[model samples]
Target: MNLFVVKLSLCFLLFSKITFGQETLEYKLNIGDNLIITQVATQEIVQNMNGSKHEMLNNLECDFNLIVTAKTDSSYVINFSFKRLKIKTMSNIYGELMNVDTSTELKEGNFEAKMFAGLTNSVLKMEMLKTGKIVKITGTEAMIKKMVNKTGIEDEFTKELMFEAIKKEYGNESLSRSFEQMTYCYPEKKVSVGDQWTNNFSGNLIAKNTWTLKEINKSIILSGKSNISMNSQEESYVMKLKGTQETEIIANKKSGFPELITVTSNTQGTSITDQMGKLEIPTTIKSKTIYKTKKYVQ
Candidate 1:
């Protein structure tokens, strides 16, 4: 399920916890603060058209180097570095469609993607990557490639058009369709992980998603996790996901952001056998990240 939403979110890559700089950390993001994004996705999508449940697993490590511009309005120019990118699963693990229990770690390799946008009045510019992530994953990761293409039009449209696409995509109602839903919202008067915020005015966080808010210099930080139930006609499913997330906070002198968080997350999931349980193969996503956001810009 987590993989489902993360993959679903590929259609929409956006950011910030609303109040902008004011997160768990009491301080406001100054010019040097950088916004970091580390995503760990482990999905086991098993569709048995032939009355068989097969699965696979994917473990990838991605990191982004972001420099919060001196001008707050200008979005940070980030160079996305794919660290430890690999594919592993018990089965053939051929296509994006996969089912698995354990994953095989691969040799270390590097890939890259870059995005340039920060606090622009134009939402679209913020939505579209400074470059295209489409071709990058297409041949190697076809399933994800489909997702990138199916949604988020970054074509010849003006900057304004791209943003409009993002808003409309997020606003879609189907986004909430998930099992054991854990949505993240923020209270009106400055809230943190322990605080309560409704979906409507949910700070910068959208509704029906699992959010990880750690304190970066005493401010609420924005991170996310999501679980999605596959399109299964089956009635019963035994699902299990065990993983790890390591977090940190640092004041990056270059960006001025109060924290550089790294979530070294990895998990393995397996569905207990049950005729009534429909959820299929379980998987784990391993991620190692380094993100610096501006909270106290020196």
Candidate 2:
């Protein structure tokens, strides 16, 4: 009876260690650390209008870099810049709509090329907390000006119009909101395997995300599920959508930066257009996105 009791206690101790071991996860980077992240995304959109189905395809690929320039006890100041940008779009109705690659020489009169090229030269400065929250972002005004100048539009009014249009998507507020979806995944407290937490993202897309720590080994594995809603309006149309997204991430244990991340989402809703006499056209979109990151040395 004594032997049995001792063995049972030993088993309980082992089980507790395996189940409740906690680890702190946060960004741990030093000044001069450079991280290069490449993202690839593919999207398919289907719309039913006037009893006909139309489909569009979009493919996007880009490389961005983050360099830690300064660090405080609680936060890091980083510089973010786009290294390359490429986009391709096609539709059943329009065939090939636009293709732009910043790596290649731009065509003289290609507006899309001129517009996207500007991103490669612009840098955004951000102050990010060690807990993965972005507290402040600057340089959007200069970035927008550079983008507009790349277009070579001589009229000040045209440049102003372009600047405002671009600001909706690339302004300081917009960038902070968009980047939070990636940077705001960490919890304030320590976590063990199988622990779960919740966060949120808001912008053109609003998502409530639930994340789980699946495993901790050579690399940490995390998974997430998000319930998303989107609302977008332009001069002539408005889009409303609801969807679900699934995400998987492999993150470096030391730096807390993602090594690889993948996400899949499906959304469906309606498009209301003035041209359609306020008709509600059924629309659906499916997308897959992948991000790969590595520390750059040199």
Candidate 3:
């Protein structure tokens, strides 16, 4: 379920509060406003040489939802914990939040946060309900677990590396695939847009990464890359990272806000390249955020 890993990364990250009673939420983090973690899966297709493949996309896309609450009591800090008990083989997608906000700064205060895992990459994240700067990181469980102090994660594998892991564990046919979860946080990001930052994680996985914020149009976009690989797919699982993803939010007239995020995942791997047949995944990838924000408060 390589698609599951990829979609899990996005779905877990997008599991915000929706107002219309859908999987999304619109509630502001009040003193006790709760957050829900949802993982959405839909039929996935792999680009082929001629066109695309859509054969067994049946119930392959399974989605689950859960509720989470912030444990932090301050507004100027980042904190969260991955409940290892949630899933034995999966991680949260909180590492991606680092890109959502890069200008966070931690003031004098104390903070603690917690993360939970649901089946199918579904997980929840909650920080101290803060009216000040709130950092958000979104990624898989591994990344989410190690990301900043906003999130942290270390990976040395590619999506193809992950594909091979799937082939090894489940045996080819392309039935299931998974990868390390990623997490990042900016408890305090107050640098200018052009400023750069770097961090590292060491544990079951070792990872290093660099990041920069570029203000395009009127939005401050987040861009960065991590050296991820298949360190030990031996008896466990591994994910072949396609590559770095550059993302930006564009304004949606109908939504009255930037509800769309155009993400370009830059990666180069044999399997990914071969999947395209003759075409290429392009040096830059172009994808969209699953959900758009109707309104946001800083």
Candidate 4:
């Protein structure tokens, strides 16, 4: 009888240990929370034109601050503001090198006349879920229009191009899609460490994302793989892009907010255009982007 009692006690302890070890973590939003995120990226692009190769190196940096103003049972209303944007590009075309920087003031050429000087300090409002899904983005179009008007671009052609590009990039549909990709792709149900889920995105490009909860130490780590098929047509060109990307996210386990995120992607594409009369140029692009975040006030 004593032996049977000992065996039963051992079984209870084992069951309790297993249950405690597999406890799930739940994430919810809180008002008055602020997170500042900074992103930096560098890209190497190679294009073949008329049996010759041209290469460009591009660098980009941006900063955003997210402030939660209100929260419901299932969602949060957040205000996102951009503090800075900087882009620098270097290209060697036909043995001549040229550089363009958006943060610098240009004195001559159409670039100077149409430069986006007021792109910084833009703000957008968002309705988002605690699971990192964005339901809607507001005030983006108005902000873009304001920035364009502030440029005071003199040339009509350049002004039109700039306006169109900014609108396409920050407009509601595009911004929503972009924000979706920024998530770690959480599942609908509560998940424990080592859980996995798949996220799909459809837009000008279609990408299949597979994300896994990799680790749970003091912080949580989420890793992902994305397969991309991109196609887009503008007035000047039609581009088809195929690529693969790998992503990693490190989050504060208590708050469920990301502290750092990294993404690396490699793509190859063909651009068909009339720049040289129905020309088809093959291109390759590789980029690595890192985002770091910290707590902020206001």
Candidate 5:
């Protein structure tokens, strides 16, 4: 009887150890690793402008690749390039505003197509820590130059203007902050299942996020909630919004690369525009985004 009780206690202890083990969730990437990532986002925007309701629907699909170029003891150098981009937008006020596909032949004099075509063949260099912190990103200036040149504008003044305009959205700082949302999800120390951590993102959109490790199996399941604020400015308009977002991620166990991610958010605020004598319009936006990643090693 005593031997049977001792064996039962040993089994319970082993089960407890397996269920409560701590894990270091850092990227374990190797050189020559390639990751193909696809992102799809859909947004619905509603605005009350001059006592009239206006609605717009926008869908964006993008494909990009990341290659591990060099690895240090603590960091990795990666090359990132866009493979394709597609956008479709519809507005109740303007009907179909844009429909562009970079994978297909670009139509002559199509401004949207010409603008997005610049993203192809341009590579950006990124330095990231094993802990998933993006240290620095380079090559945005060259990318902006390529994009402006692809527009085929003749006048230098016009090109300069276009360069500045594109820089607002695709600048080095902007890209770094935008990509950090994907990479900056790891804890500084090891954690076990049910453990939670916090991270923050700053850019045009700011988010204070809380991440929880929900499950640890063949793949890790993580869930996140964020309080988001948006403050963006353009030549003609300034937008301020506040909202919350929920995110779910399923990641590869070995490499810590996310296999799938989904995010949903809703924001409400006002857009102040200078186009017509400084009007402040009430606006709301609901968005859903999904990311899928595939890995290849050569």
Candidate 6:
């Protein structure tokens, strides 16, 4: 059922006609709105170390609830919670193979074995401006501890470090990108039905985006391109990384909330370290991510 919706969205994007309204429109969120978002992804990576090849395949799904909890003069306080998560990973290294699968599902009798453990229970309270920018994220150390303990992690230091890492990086890379893709929909000013606007977020990771309003269909379309490049050299080793991504988003015209988002990315990197200094390892990664809003209120 969800897959069918995704395909229909693609067809709509390709065949939808454009219309222009006489007046400018405001596409902003209101108080008391709730958005139920789901993310599904698949990825593959290949690494070449000297003459040996290693490959990994990953599949992941996550569910989130975004609720508007409060309103201010220029911004809104939103509560975001991770409701469920499932992940599967398989790898082949030099002819040896490994696989891992985990899900945070609650069962009648098997609670301990089915929990996602460290992530499905965490919540991030965010302050978002009317223009769709996230200005703050409230911390939740206690929540992280609950997840770590539920997952059977015994080390206190490891749990503490895990919480700190999530606070700094906002969960895994894929999760962070999911929120980033939604926040990128904010336009600076009012726009007509056919007007196009550009928004960008720049830092260690950079993104350039363009958004168009489809007035007749009452949908907003967004397209984006992003890249990252890093290089480091020391007396003992050298490393280099490069990656690029493209994204498409379809959003609700009245509320500026994303309905469907698709992202495709590729990364390639090289690394050499320590006594392995003479050996050069090259890695290539390709990924596809899709986020769909299952239930949304405008």
Residue 56's C-alpha lDDT in candidate 4? 88
TM-score of each: 0.33, 0.92, 0.33, 0.84, 0.92, 0.72
Tell me how many residue pairs clash in candidate 4.
0
Q: Can you write out model 2's per-residue Cα lDDT over 46-115, one digit (the tens) per residue?
A: 9998788889999999998999999999889999998899999999998989999999999998898998
For model 4, how does the per-residue alpha-carbon lDDT over 1-298 read when each residue is reduced to its tens digit? 6999999999999988767666344345578888888889999989898778889888878777888989887778988877766666777864424444445665465342233445556678888876777888898767776667766767878767777887787787788777777753667765567778887877775789888888888988889999998788888888888999999988877777777889899999888887867677898889999989866443
Give lDDT for model 1: 0.33
Residue-level lDDT of model 3, residues 125-228, one tens digit each, is 32322322223323233333322212112344543454343333222111112211222312133444455666543333344556565543344344545553
State residue 265's C-alpha deviation in candidate 4, in Å: 0.6
Task: Give residue 59's error in model 2 in angstroms.
Answer: 0.3
As for lDDT, the candidate ahead, 2 or 3, is: 2
Off by over 4 Å in 4: 1-27, 94-115, 154-162, 296-298
Clashing pairs in 6: 104-116
Pick out the ten consecutive residues of candidate 5 with the lowest summed lDDT.
289-298
Separate clash counts for every candidate: 40, 0, 75, 0, 0, 1
- Give the higher-lDDT candidate: 2 or 4: 2
- Worst-scoring 10-residue span by lDDT in model 3: 172-181
TM-score (C-alpha, index-matched) for candidate 3 = 0.33
Candidate 1 ranges beyond 4 A from true positions: 1-27, 34-38, 70-188, 192-194, 200-298
State the lDDT of candidate 1 residue by residue for 252-295, as single tens digits: 32332335444345555555456635545554435454444322
Which parts of model 2 have CA positions greater than 4 angstroms off?
Answer: 1-20
Q: lDDT per residue, candidate 6, 164-235, as tens digits? A: 654444543334443655675656665666567776654334556666665435676666666655455655
How well does model 5 score by local distance difference test? 0.90
